[model samples]
Target: MFRFTDYGEEDAIRLCKELVRIESTDPGSYEGRISEYIYETLRQELGADGVRLCRSEVLTGRRNLLAELPGSSAPAGSGKEEPALVLICHMDTVVAGEGWSEETGGPFSAAERDGRIYGRGSCDMKSGLACALTAFCREAGERRLRQGEKAPEKYRTLRFIASVDEEDFMRGAERVIRDGWVSASDWVMDLEPTDGRIQNCHKGRVWFEAEAEGVTAHASMPEQGTDAILALSYFICALREEVAKLPEDERMGRTTITFGQITGGYRPYVVPDHAKVWIDLRTVPPTDSRMLRELLGRAERAATEKVPGSKFRILLTGDRQSIPPCPKSRLLQSLRQAVREATGEEAVVSLFPGYTDTAVIAGTLGNENCLSYGPGKLRLAHKPNEYVDISDIRRVMRVLRCLLREPLR
Candidate 1:
């Protein structure tokens, strides 16, 4: 059996700091450097034969890494096959925006203070990645040690995937699914900073860009032309009203909408000819494409009626469907058992408000056994002075060790 020790905890923390220092900021530095670092590190730990890197088809010059440990077969014609377990972590983080505290050095400093690791990706996820890596490598090493033993315990095949572009369009995950690296029967878990809770369901997401068009006019002739900015404002109000009518869930809460970005008039002296607003909708069940279309239609009609000659257009930029909750899943039961053995406490089940790579997997591949559970708080992700407690990483490592050591039916 592979056991986690004090030294292993220290090594996991160190690995997290190194990952944070690599600067894999999405839409900024990109994940090339960090991907290379992870590929090299896994290669060294698991050997070249056990690890492979695949270049992303969507993102240029970026790659995803996969490391595998094959499982032993059932003994003496028992006619039993072990299931495969995939551990997933994204190698990309959101851009290190402004508002960082000087005491933490910088956004990529990966500083340690009072048992916390501070950096851009520290809390959002690098800590989870470190824990998963440590657990996987330890198990692989133990399997190697038992090579010549007379009777070693049979275990499930284990695979660790480090994907790219998770903070953006999730192209890496799409590629992983397209390449058939993961099947619908395989158990998958994404380390997405769930604050140590197992998130069995995820909120659906849809990104929209609403454009309002009107004739531009000079400030002196206010009545000569319509204002697109005013029309957009009306559209926003109508959209909010429509969104508020959507159904709510007890676990996932009410469907929410956020105006991420808006642009209107160029100058105070002129009536703008065009205005656009980017909207994000986080939805729950019973909120499907037909409902979205109906809501937008109602909002557009209300806006155009209020502002005559002003046309409104809505575009669907992205859509990620929700994963319904599976409280009685075998994967959840296994994880709960692992948590009990590791921490002597019952596991908490919850719903993730935001979307994740596992959403892409479940949506695209119809995999219901996938879930997210890891170190750090989701609230601290993509924010200034993000940090993860060292103790949290250790706790997650313990849970992962217990999970890896057991057999998944």
Candidate 2:
């Protein structure tokens, strides 16, 4: 098994700092600028080991820059084999709007202070991405001595899949599937900011819309028209009560529903006849979504029973399932070893409360053997002044290197 202490600290810090300087966020302002930066860095700096760039269809100016240094003791074509372990990282950040004055100069301006790198994506992902890069780069560098006719036939392929658009739509990973980039592999190691924890579970979302129709009447004539707002409030309360009782799963915890938005009013002089609200449902396993439709029927009945003249309707605006706990016992055990090799401490793991692009990989790939590891504190994701631990990046880098070099038994 490979260990975390194998990789150099200086290398990890360099990769993280350079990427942080690019400010690659949502619809990265400098898409070409950032992609080209990687291209030049690897092609020029590590070209001796043979680095290749793979363009993606997701971002126009950007691309999934892949660097592969043919392993020593690996089959000729084995360098691109299935069930292959991939180092996944994104090249984008949320909008850096505020709370970055303490950083270099602005939100995108990265600063290293007190061992933490301060910036927009410093904590959310850039750190993890850098870790993956460092480990893979070391392998890339190691290839210099293993290339040509003397290279070994048994070797692990270290891939650096740096993509774009993970901040918003996750179009990067989506495009990777559409174009069959990683389809050959059973699973990919999603390098997100997990505070060096292994994540294999997360909650998904179901967006629905509920409408309450009411009659309009003059405000002065209280008995003339129906109050849609009042009807909506009553409907909301019933929905809340019904949603509160949703069953819970041991892995993802209890399912939940919340009223995200509501708007319905015609005029100040008239009672609102139209009221609509958006309901968001966080689902867990064994909880069938079809049951929600049944709940809607009950809600309508309750509304009708409460207000004889009031009418209601429900629509399934959106439906997305949470990626269940794959928890591949063997894979987790292997990863635990990797984590130990990557960090001196025991691997910290838990279910990710929110959603992740891992859903895409889990669906397209296998789940049982799937595992996630990366740098950056998840608590900083999507928040202002998000930063990653510079030292943490190096630590994970060391771990990734060992994982790639570890021989298949």
Predicted structure with the largest TM-score when compared to the true one: 1
- Per-residue lDDT tens digits for candidate 1, residues 232-274, read 9999999899999888887788889999999988799998889
Candidate 2 lDDT, tens digit per residue, 1-409?
Answer: 1122334776666667667777776744735666777667666556453556566656567676777554434354655443556667777777777655544556665777788777777776767766776677567656655555453546654566777776655677777767665654444677787776788777767778888888888899957777777777887888778877888887779888888788998778888888999988888876656988887777777776776567887889766677777555555666778778766668866787655556666655544555577777788887777778776777676777667767765
Model 2, residue 340: distance off in Å is 1.8
Q: What is the TM-score of each candidate against the true structure?
A: 0.95, 0.81
Reference-based lDDT, residue 314, model 2 = 83
Q: How far out, in Å, is residue 95 in model 2?
A: 2.8
- The lDDT for every candidate, in the order shown, is 0.85, 0.69
